[model samples]
Target chain A: MEQSYLIDLKQVVKRFPMGKGSFTALKGLDLQFEAGEFAGLIGPSGSGKTTLLNIIGTLDLPSEGGGTVLGHPIEHLKASEAALLRKERIGFIFQSYNLLQVHTVFENVEFPLLLLGMPSEERRKKVMEALDWVGLADRHRSRPSQLSGGECQRVAIARAMVKQPSLVLADEPTANLDAANSHHVLKTMQQLNEAFQTTFLFATHDEKVISYLKRKIYLMDGQLVKDERV
Target chain B: MKLAWLLAWRNLMGAGLRTFLNVLVLSFAFVMILWMEGVMVGWDQQSKEDMRAWSIGAGQYWHPAYDAYDVLSLTDAHAVIPKETVRSGLVPVLATQASLFPQGRMMPVRLNGIPSQQSLLKLPTAALDTTMDAIPALMGTSMASKVHLNRGDRVLVQWRDRNGTFDAMEIELVDVFQTTVPAVDAGQVWIDLSVLQELMMLPNEATWLTMGEATVDSERMAPFVWKPFSELTRDIDAMIETKSSGQAVFYVVLLLLAMLAIFDTQVLSIFRRQKEIGTYVALGYTRREVVWLFTVEGSMHAVLAALLAAVYGIPLLWWQSVVGFTIPMDTEGFGMAIAPTLYPVYSLGLVVTTFVLVLITTGLVSYWPSRRIAKMNPTDALRGKIQ
Candidate 1:
């Protein structure tokens, strides 16, 4: 059976104002992704890849047009409601592995659950399971600074997947890693994706990242130039 | 809420140097504020105690004339004095000036004459008994020394009669009184009331009466026409008011400086963590949540500082209160024998107020920055720039 589309972006637009003029970061783009689909948004620098990811992540609203995510109308939701939706259903992984530097690996994974007001026992169970999935269960007590690049990315992945959200947005998650570390992180993420059946969306210019995705989205400037299946 | 608190705690600990400097500055400010408040309250309480000792005698009292110079005539006393007033508990005393001669050396001295021994008993104990009869006069230590009189020596008390006739009487000095306040005891004599009446030639009248206990109920006392010692200490009251105004002005300036320091540090902390705050917002925390989180952090800092200040402050204040801070022995004219000491009295209200002030200022200063976090696109935060 074909799963329904979880994210649908229709003619999304974003603009930036420079001195005496304007810069269009996203010039009327349309995109859609089905549930459980592993997709990659491949674009060069300044191609509005992060902007589009932000819009889908509900971190930024479209200046023009409307869309929906996970059956909720994005345009109609208030800032608080959008935040609620993000907390409950959306998970984010950043390029720099934005785990709170002061928190240990386990604590970073437990953060979203804490925000969700989950009880300690349940949060521990979920966090441990997520850490086990990332193969970082032994390094649970290590802080971000103590971890290597691959370990940090794995911790970030654990943080993203611990909440068991329906959608996981990864923005250049392997940009900071070496070739070997990058391959390891990608393998760990693919394994988690298969095991949890959580949809993965990657915004990256890395050919390595694009090759791993089942669907590829190509962007030029602020517009989508191509969409293809592997 | 717990997550926010945890984040705040760890952030405070993560940057050791910044946290130390911030807490040091805050603790110093806290100490200054606590000390100032303590001094003000201590001074007020001391003044009240002094007043009670001198006039009201710890509680309240009623007197004959509102103005000290408006003598309590026999007729006026009957009209103003309450009908069921506790007479036995009241002490009638005469205060006047008299000329004295010791071996041909003459000087004027203030004389306080009480009706009975019980009245003198209520006065605080100096080295000598405050009570004296015709044969046993209590002379101030300074007066006794100047007059070259031993315990058995006699002095001539001379004064002008109501008719302008000059008269002299000799009395034996039985005891010499030494007080903590040397100035008060130096030029005064306490004698029995009958001897005073004979000397002043007002055999049937008393100058003012002191109540050993409160005769006027606080509620009823305000509306009732009553006299107080304020009339006698009008000049002193003016001087005290001037001193109070100066202290208040000084404290206001100090508090303003302290507030500015608190404001600056909190603002700097928020600005430095702007990106992190934006990330928190992007992680589904609202603007209000951000504000509350920082406010709670500031409050926690204040509470910790307050606890430490209390530990150090209480002992210092108590020691100062008990032993007193000493001034140079050679300092003259001020006549303050027991030197001024600041005793900070800690109250829950003060702690609460300090905490609230810190929290509110932190919330206000961090408000705009935290709200900016909510307004930023998460991608910008992730990129470490809002623009």
Candidate 2:
């Protein structure tokens, strides 16, 4: 069978109001993401890489055209429904490593499962397993602040993957990390993708992240200029 | 809501010092509000009791013209004792305006006549039962202290009889008693009923009959107007209520200050933790759920405060109620039945009311700033951007 698309963006357009006139961030871009595909949207500044990521993550709505994720129409989706979509299906990893600083590593990882209303014993097992993948199983009790930058990023990864979501959207996951830590995080994500067949998408200009992508889509000036296999 | 509460509790605890300070201030507010209100309520209760025990005995039957509040009403307030006066529970007492001299200073006084053996009042009149060489008299400690008089002291007493003629005599002060009822203690003197009857030439006539523990039908004969205990003490009750209402303002102010701290902290937390808020949304919480979490977190401070206040307030209040609150100032100066020290009474209702009030107040304040989240854009919030 032909590869199925988990994400299908068609003629998507996004504009933001600036001063008097509006600024177009994404113009009529079409993109498809298949299950278990490791893909990246690569571009320089102002190329709408993050915007497209946000739109696909269901954090933003298209000004004109829209898309679908897991067969749910992105346009006209109520805020609550969109939130439910993000909650049940989409996982996000930010460049800033947006881990809840106050929570311990385990608590951070267990957050999603808690939201899913999972039982305590099950949550514990899943959290520990996710931590194990990030190689932070022994550091589950440590707060985000107490961990190193690389460790914090790994905790963020654990938190994202803890619920075993269908899709993970990473925005420059390695933007703040060194070469060794970046490779470690990418390799872990790679293992999770292969092992669970979870769809992985990245919005990044980082060469290290770009190198790991099975497919690279290049954008400039708010339009896709190229799309190709790595 | 369970999920919200759990997450809220975790967040508040993780906040550490910020949470502790808010809880501390709010707790102190709880203790202060409850303690102050309990004491005032206790005072109101005590005053009513003191009035009942010292003066209004369960109720009274006043001569139609008799008004204890009006000095002029006393001039002709006396009437023949109502037939109800013969009842076992009725204690008929005569009162007439008189002038007394102590240390050569003349002062007006209510010279009341009571049966020395009567058990109806707590007047300590047994002192008058003594057969002294001079006239046996009883004056409250406040009157005695004010006039520089003491027990066994001979002083001049003068009064008008039914003939409207002035009479004078030197009578010995037999006893000076202390009483909590201001009306009973201030500038009042007590003497034998028979002697007063003879002196006033109005046999079996009285201004009022103080009802004892038993009830009497004063309406049977209708010589005097029957005033129930509550009606007799109406003014005092109103005064206490008015005072309590005024005191409520201070309590609100205290709570507001405490909640102000909480409100300020909530606003600051939302402002500083925009990214965390976004992360929560990204994790799956609805905006409304986040608002509720902050509300519970803020209100939980009150719960913590109440527990903390209980740790100290219970002991302090208990000790006070037992020992009684002493007035630091002279009791004679208060002009009313104010006990020197007031024992605070904390009823279960009062405690529960204060708890609920604080929780509601804190919850509302927490929700106020958390509303900013409802208007927040998660995409921008994810990057720690305002708006």
Candidate 3:
């Protein structure tokens, strides 16, 4: 019943079916996040960083755990309830920059607002604001296919930020970009984080992404190894 | 649903040629189903019109003993012509079996006798009122051609009377008229009703009376049963029904082919665009919403096809209705009533029905493949993995 943290987990475990046996993606772990925190779940491959991030994002549920995200019990949320939680309170940014290829940058960024049934004029204004935050306001008419890797990531960030959700879950958001593009994307996220005071949770092992985080939680073989604050 | 439609429309338009090709094939089905159905309806209408004009005017009253399919029944099918029926302007017809020797070749024919000056029917009965020495007889062009006789030719006609007495006479082919109704033409001859009555020794008698302007609804007159218009045109109606069933098969196949293309596209879209589907879910769409999105996307092909079909079909179908379709071969051999050129008739019901059918069928076809999305994992789909 402790609903103080934005996301709270205790004794959480996640398992996947693998040919007559089970693969434990995450071991018994205790974690918590507060409002407006900039943090990262840092680990190498097969170390359960993405699994924990997914659990917090409400995209997946822990097999045996008591978890709450934004005052909603993660394990008890129905499909629509989970979807609504994601829709109104959480945003996601993937490493691949999964922008709709057929849509212009403006349309892509405006999608979440459209889902919320926002009025078109107001939706357009908010979309322009999000694009300005990412410094891609002038490229609103260009499609994802027409944008560079860094620009597409920026558009994804704007899309995640357009609705101004309480939390944003980003998984390896800069993995596909070069060093310059990676630093550029990171700077935009850092600025957006400070300007909006929105909580940012990332699942990554990249040192560049790790360097920008104010708090880092390290995982090793599905167990929490360390929690550090800069 | 509106948002889904808008997104589907944009997606289809963005797809460009793939969407166009599917629409093109589906549009072909739309036009063909409508066009062919229209022609069938027109054929039915034309046949009924021709029959009504040339033969059975409004309806007919047949003698109790008459069986059109039984040739021997002609011997006893005659009854005295009803005075009240005559007063109602109905045309009485008397038919008897006869043998005609044209150029010494014998052939059996039905000698149908109608009033020479009757205006109730479109047959050239007035041509029977001739001043020639021999009896004036009129036959259809097919019969005339079959007998190899022209106008002014004389042929020997022999027949039997009520008393079983044989008699012979020479009749002149006064008129060889052209008519589309096979019932009124083909192996039949028309002459003065009075002359046939006198020859058969059964005066004031007729086999049947074709109702004219004033339709009679009398069952009181025994030995004469009233046949309504629908009853009289039963064979033609049955033939049209059979043709309609055949047409249903044709268009169903046409629809299936178009649906196959849509089904293939939907299957391919679900597999090839896994990332998009996952993105949709990650963007806060329910799996069911994603399924509906794909279904709407597929169904939109029919909408686009209908519009595209309308772009070309309206003018083409209109032109066809006006100019009519001409059969490439002779229709005379077709036993029932048919025209050399057929004009199609389109109704609002037909067009709307075809449109709805294509829409529903395409939706079902699209939905069948889209159900797979509900089972897909968002994490896996985001990774573009086929699950």
Candidate 4:
């Protein structure tokens, strides 16, 4: 039963302190994600899309009820355990293309594998293969600052998929890109998800991203409003 | 640990000028500390060497009544030389109190009597044996200049005989000697031992006997204390130790400036690289790992600085040792054993100790600020928040 779900959340509530009292970010939300699903948490700002993405990524703990991610309890996990879970099983792509500015494209893509303690020869082979997938194999030596918006996103996707993780969490992955680059990054992620059958979870309000997701979950004011198969 | 070292090295290299400036500052500290300490060590060795040559040859045998500091003790300090010491090694020297009138001004003086034919010590006392009008004597350059006496000049000397009667005579200054050691040259006059004994009415008696090594049998020499070279120079050693302790403050200040540069760099790196730190965490690095990465980066500054110091410091320190450092003050009457120019002597231990001190200091300075990373919230850090 646990193998069927990559992420399983039940009665999850998240709150953050605002001045004196606490503000509820997620209230009694239940969500289940099956393996190899291309899903998006679609909501506007203040609807907790980023919050949910962070929770799923084990970057935050639920304040009220808890859930499991990759068969490990998410709420109040030790820092080392959470790091290991994220390191071995989860991948993240941020809106600003959080590629290390100083590292070349190859080094950035190879970072996660390095943390996973992969040896040099195999790590090089896997990194090159991931670069080949993102179509940035020729730009491996180029730094992030030298790349365009679309190229930087391609580098980020290459970095995320280099480890071939079970789930990749992208937070507004196309926010900084124009329409052409947005669709290009989205279509690349779509192809990577289908080819590797790796689960992809996106937090975005962008319509272009919505059109690509196989399933969309809509949240409004700390509550899930709709779930639909696109 | 190897991965941390590798990434830390890469990060430092990528930092470019900021890293270079920190390393340069730390390197300066290493050079300054080592140089200063080398000078002190050189000074200590030179003082001991000069003492051994000019004044206390290996050791000395003092008469029970003799105390070099108290002039009254010198009057009664003389005793007949021991028979056992006369054959192989010991050379007797008669020390007595006297007064001189040079340029019509009264000056207190020590009249040291040395055998004209002895080679057991470094004093140029052979110059005292001369066929001159008055008793041939030698005065240090300091005493010569103060008394306005030249090599051939005669000065009036007053002394006491065996009957406690006062006597006056003119003594020829056969030679004026130059030496770095103040003990031999300050307010002192040297005369032939036979002549001094004849004048003082104390024949065949000496204040102390100098020998080549510590071979004097203390049991046979019952009333006399045989002072070895180690005991003879204990005061000088203590003085140098006290001076070194006072100088440790300067070393601390120098190291503090270097450490401040490193500490500032580490704190700034933590602030500026928070995003990179978060990225590291998100990539599955424990917060502890990130701390280690930053710590290694900071401590590596000392390593780089040590290399940099070797590039420039080696030649400079070697040249300084060869050329020696000249003091600005006139050393003519500076009453202690010191040379006009001091040559630095650096032992292997001094160099290694200094390096370890800087390395440990840098590691601590780096770790103090980097510890904050372990407490940083991963989610906030990922957003590049200031927390």
DockQ of each: 0.54, 0.76, 0.70, 0.70
Docking class of 3: medium
Error of 2 at A112 (Å): 1.1
Q: Please rank every candidate by lDDT, starting with the best.
A: 3, 4, 2, 1
Question: What's the residue-level lDDT of A21 in candidate 3?
Answer: 98
Worst 10 residues of 3 chain B by lDDT: B215-224
Model 4 agreement with the true structure over A72-189: per-residue lDDT tens digits:
8888698889999989989999888888887789989998988888999999999999999989999999988899999999899999899999999999999999999999899999
Candidates 2 and 3 compared: the better one by TM-score is 3
- Model 3: DockQ score: 0.70
Q: How well is candidate 4 docked (DockQ)?
A: 0.70
TM-score of chain B of 1: 0.67
Residue pairs with backbone overlap in model 1 = none
Which candidate has the top score in DockQ? Answer: 2
For TM-score, the strongest prediction is 3
lDDT per residue (tens digit) for residues A29-79 in model 1: 888888888898889999989888888888777788767888777768788
Stretches of model 3 off by over 4 angstroms after superposition: A1-3, B217-222
The TM-score obtained by model 3 is 0.96
Best by lDDT: 3
Per residue, candidate 3 scores C-alpha lDDT tens digits across A1-230 of 83599888989999999999999989999999998899999999999998888888877889998678898998898989988888888889999999988889999999899889899999999999999999999999998889999999999999999999999999999999999999999999899888888999999989999999999999999999999988
DockQ of 1: 0.54
Alpha carbon deviation, residue B308, candidate 1 (Å): 2.7
